[model samples]
Target: MAGRQGGHHIACTGLSAFPLTPMRDDAVDERAFAAQVARVAASGVDSIGALGSTGVYPYLSRAERARVARVTVEHADGVPVIVGVGSLRTSHVLEHVDDAVEAGAAAVLLPAMSYHPLTDDDVIGLVETVAAHSPAPVIVYDNPGTTHITFTQELYARVARVPGVVSIKIPGVPTEPAAAREHVATIRGAVSEDVTIGVSGDPFATAGLAAGCDAWYSVIAGTVPEVAVRLARPALAGNAAEADAENARLAPLWQLFTEMGGSIRVIAAIAELLGIAEQPCLPLPIRGLDGEQRRRVAAVLETLDHAAEPDRDE
Candidate 1:
């Protein structure tokens, strides 16, 4: 459920689905992207993360990103949209933030999108700068894999103090229950009580939520949202056994994520397979999954065919 802080509605808690910014040829497939947004919004997820890493944030141009943000908010159908506004240059990130707010974003996810080695202070400064100017609340995105910027507990604490920061999207957490709890507990101690902690890295989602994360910033939720919701609803509701059972059921898919590299390509493959987006929908250079790999994804999908079926339980 979403919580209100003072006046701002913080929709950072629960499952926040991240949809692909589907592309056709070299340009953004606005129609396809909007459909993805509409699909996720209709899934009853708590929020929609428009342009996180799963959405291929770095590859898109400012204009494309602005259009994607506009399309996401417009199609989200009142679902809170958290647009990612991370860029190489701080100024450009702020500009993206402006575009996102203009497009009706409820919050912004700012990763330390770095090319050069960035000091901790540099990252903190970037957050402070954007938070001061951004009309929407900020989500400190600690995505070390893409950003190559590992945020220490101290770094998280320092940035969470920024006036407008409302959430922190941690990359992942420990798989073991005790370890995951300790890990999330340390970060929880560092931020404000109201600053929601959302877990990325879909495979670790149940563990993270079980360990006390406020949300699941899910990649798989973008393509096969009903399945994601199946797990997330139980997990967020404190149904540990049901959540763990669902996690075990999706073990094949999670293993595929590792075997295939990461969620980006696998999810793109799923979207294409489901006819939710076009073939070769991802931006160029990232050819998505190859034919053989796609076949494997297809096989996996067959086993999880229930994903495409309606959630009659709902």
Candidate 2:
């Protein structure tokens, strides 16, 4: 790991997760947002991902994203803030990367979002375009759950070899253990094991860590970070059993947000319930959670808090 490439290693080592901050009439409640980041940072989270899928990235204007990134970085002090730069076009996303870097983000996380499915060559080209233009190191996000396509191990290896590409964020596709381990072993054997492979989904983070993934990029990390920090840090350090126990405790909240119909929308609503944001406003076409879903989600959150406390004692 010691070479010219080794200098960028720090960008990939941390727990990268975003906080969902609900908006009130197209405006962010900065006070609430800052407090949320501060609380998460104080709980020992490695990095804060602002203006991400959890943070309602699609709803914010470019200017709003910049301001939120700046404020989040300010509140986090020395903690790294990885700003999302996912957009419809390369130029627009590149500009967002510029704004993120200017706002003092340590790195920029980007999704592969070109029209239609992308080939390995296309994925490599897209990663190169962003890495070449970004002011900071680029972390490629492979989220086939939301996005239409995911980069293959061949493409991931190629991009990992790129000059400015330091990290890759892969969502854990399997919700079960045997399959999850297979997914990790396959990817680790395919890519340079030295390149940091981060798991994004909550259900898969523990399994991903147990299977030797370097870090986690989680949305659940945003709302109830104490649980994420307490559990994930140990998992990354190679304690799979303890990690799984913690995951079991928090599984209800994870299932509520992700397993339900409107995962993203439900998350926004929960952010409001937790008092982290004023309103649960998503981008156009992504509506708020229904009343019944909100009640169920709230009930699960209570269980998460109760379950998390005992695990911390362990």
Candidate 3:
């Protein structure tokens, strides 16, 4: 947090777009994956988050993830790339971090991915070990929904003290503006000022940023970057009202996320409808939104397309 890590500040602030790792025929679709990286890079996002939860990091093999990190750096057009390195085992996580850094990743997103419950010491040890071994900076990822490990403020303070730790990606902020601001402030106070706090939970990206979180670690941005960027620009500019307006504009998109149960399927559905990926792009047994669900997703996309608005960039 004292800036000792010295990597790009994208880990701390700005919009880091998480692009999907598309699959086809039960294989990692390198072509589709490359295209996704290139598309996110083209959008002028602050950074490219490769192999994130949105990118299905835990679903792929180490070799596949290494290849993905390479593809992401190659297609990122010089945009910094943060690779996810989370696994059930510490040994595997270390291996993934090495592979990611060797593949030219700018930073590594480390989460305590566990099949068994993890103690605070276990998670802390994981962070310390990675920070010690990997040259790439570490972004602590706190995703209780998927990883089943919630981070306490005390944990944040402890991890932020690790030499190479640069960012902490927290879950959604409170819906109420005052509460959201307080939530972000408490975390900010826990860590050194150099450590950036990023907000995940796509629906609350705007509020998180507006409340003073420096970065938006976004999932939906992986599919529709322009919309996410539109919201971020204003929020980062300190124009909270404008950012909220933009978020309000994507009400249908957010509704779809809640209705479809989660972001992955809905995003995969959007990717297919946009022709960025083929149907069944997700890994096996996880068949993406199908038939009627897909139709509903399509209608949402169509509405978004029909009502598209211009951002300042335009």
Candidate 4:
């Protein structure tokens, strides 16, 4: 797996936080979104991902998405901002990339979006074309859960060879600590050593880092960045025992994410509970957490926040 190497590395290793796109009355809440970005940056996350899956990229119009990207970069406060540029069409994806670049984003994340299942060659062509067109570095997002297209190790190796492709964000968590380690090692061996491998699905972050993945592309961090930093710091520092302990503390929140269907609902509820934004998601049929669900989520968030607080005596 070899190709020309000219992609600019955006220093996105470690805990890369994905911030949710706060909405107000079916419109992108620019002020709330900027506050969210600032909050994550203040929490010491390595990078900020705007318009990620949790950001509801597909649900928003191009102009709205571009505005989010611009606000994210502006509020990131020198922290690198990675903009998601995934669209069903290659041409549209390229347009998004240009918008991200023009908006001063540091990097771009591209997922293979398809209404029909894509072949290996089709996926490869998509990445190559995007990488060739993107002025900034491209992070290949392999989220089979949403896109229904998985990037195997072989495909990753091929995509890694594309010029300007600097990283890959893989989804799902490994079954165990050992499996997580093995998974990272296998992917690292398959691609160029210079290529960073980041794992999404926040619950798997500790294990992914313990296994040696370079970064954690987190959903939970979109709202609760402090918890994410606590988990990431230990894992990145090679403190497996501490990382595992942190992960244990996060178990309740992770459970809520699983029970609530996904992070979007739970995070929207958390954002509202924290008074950061109002409860608004992608329109009907894809609503935010209901009243009962909000109460339950608020309870969990309260408990977690209390547990994370430092002792007053100290």
Q: What is the C-alpha RMSD of each candidate to the true structure, in Å?
A: 3.9, 4.7, 4.0, 4.4
Q: Give the higher-lDDT candidate: 3 or 4.
A: 3
For residues 254-273, what per-residue lDDT tens digits would candidate 3 score against the true structure?
A: 88888877799999988877
Candidate 2: what lDDT?
Answer: 0.73
Cα-based TM-score, every candidate: 0.94, 0.88, 0.94, 0.93
Q: Which regions of candidate 1 are displaced past 4 Å?
A: 1-8, 305-314
lDDT of every predicted structure (CA atoms): 0.87, 0.73, 0.85, 0.82
The regions of model 3 sitting more than 4 angstroms off are 1-11, 305-314
Clashing pairs in 3: none
Residues 1-314, model 2: lDDT tens digits: 11222112245775776887656666876777787788777777778888777777766788888889888888886778888888877788888988887888777888876567777786777778888877687777887766667677787778788767667788774767788788888877777655678888777778887776777887877767877787887788887778778888877766775667535766676676666665555555666776888788878777755212211111
Angstrom error of the Cα, residue 279, model 4: value is 2.0
Please tell me which predicted candidate would have the highest lDDT against the true structure: 1
| Candidate 1 colliding pairs | none
User: Ten consecutive residues with minimal summed lDDT in candidate 3?
Assistant: 305-314
Misplaced by over 4 Å in model 4 are 1-9, 306-314
- Model 1 error, position 263 (Å): 0.8
